[model samples]
Target: MKYAVFTGATGGLGTLCVKELSRLANWMVFAGGTKEAELEKLGKLPNIIPVRLDVTKQESVNATLEIIKSYTNKLDAIVNFAGMTSFTSLIEGESVEAIEKLLNVNVVGTARVNRTFFDMLYQGHGRIINCSSESGWMTPQPFAGPYVLSKYAVDAYNDSLRRELIYLGIPVIKIQPGSYETNITQQVYENFDKTISNTKYYKKLLTKMKPLMMMELNQKNDSRRLVKTVIHAMESRHPKLKYRVGTGKLLAMLELLPEGGVDVVYKLIFGKQGHL
Candidate 1:
């Protein structure tokens, strides 16, 4: 049986990924999270085993590995879907602390898991699929400073790992999808409130962005489509280095433009005062 370890199985996209992977009879999947009760519930399924994994802590990862030993010695894949995003405005003195928190989870935590599982992946000639976002490359927007920084780091991290893993016959793949229907969007307004509070400039900026945020929440791409693409990356004989799904092209085009061009586009969309 092919065994895979999937982290962040509790998030919106991760939940969908977990559900789909559970349906595959040939695949034995370890759904990773810190919630023991939820993980135990998922473990009730035929091929799914839930493991209490905290990627940020070495001890937790080591403990989880020991559990895996009881099941299988080889791992066919490690899917990192665990991540978080927060809104911030650097100009408003939004602390780098938020960025650090996200990096701890999205970048450092991911590296930790991959490093801990390297032997298993190498022994099985497995793959690593990281869930990134179009924010990795697109021009920075008004309130997503911290999130953009973390995603850019993710893009670079994936690239470096992919190069190193090539000779080892392990594929490091990145899936960059545009806005998808997820809980993240639903929390944007709340994030904005937390980040923009106590700052006059950002409060004004929020007035302008409220409508845009609402519209974006309604415009989320079909998450099932992204899930399908992800499954294809897992099953394909030769997967692409990166998979772009949904509004990826639109965001990619934004990246192609100069900074000034991007600003102009934003102005056109959000108005001269940055209000729709």
Candidate 2:
């Protein structure tokens, strides 16, 4: 039987992928999350073993490794969906602690889990799939500084890990998904609200940006589309190094411009007064 570990399995997209993966013949999935209730519910599903894991803590990751090791000596795949985000202007919103927490979960947490599980993956000659975001490659948005920074780090981390592991026959793949209908939007909204409430100098600017942020959030694509790409990355014999799903053409076009040209476009969008 094939064995796999899925972090953030309680999340919207992660839950979908875990359920779909459970339907595969002879496949066993260790669905890792910190939520006890959700993990218990997921455990009831066929071929799904729910594991309580907090990627931010090394002890939790080690415990999860022990739990999975008890069931199997090798792991065919490790899909990292465990991540967090913070939406705030770097200069005026969100505390340093909040930014550090975001980086810990989204970047360090991913590295922690992957490094912890590498031995089992090596034993099975498995693949590692990391869920980055379109923001990882796209130009930075106004209020999403912390999140964008974390994803950019993920992009770099994955590239470095992939290069180092390729010679060992371990494929490290990256999934850079566009906005998907997920709880991340809700979290972003909450963070945005906090930013607005706490800002001293950017209140007007944030107010102007609110409508645009709402519009972008509301336009998220169905997350199942992204899940399909995750499945492809998992099951394919030869998956591409990167799978980009539902990314925006405008973002792509903006990226094609010169750095100064991109800055000019942003200036026009938000106006000289910082009103969108």
Clashing pairs in 2: none
| Stretch of 10 with least lDDT, candidate 2 | 267-276
Residue lDDT tens for model 1, 1-276: 889888887667877888888888888888898766677778777788888888888999898888888988889898888888877777656557877788899899889989998898888888999888888867877778888888889999999999998888899999987886677766666777776576655565577777766665567578898889888888788999999777644456778889999899877766654433
Question: Could you give the C-alpha RMSD of every candidate to the true structure, in order shown?
Answer: 2.7, 2.0
Among these predictions, the greatest TM-score belongs to 2
- Model 2 lDDT per residue over 79-148, tens place: 9999887787777644577779989999999999999999999999999999999999998877788888
**Which segments of candidate 2 are over 4 A away from where they belong?**
273-276
Per-residue lDDT of 153 in model 1: 92
State in Å the error of residue 139, model 2: 1.1
**Candidate 1 overall Cα lDDT vs. reference?**
0.81
lDDT of each: 0.81, 0.88
Query: What would you estimate as the lDDT of candidate 2?
Result: 0.88
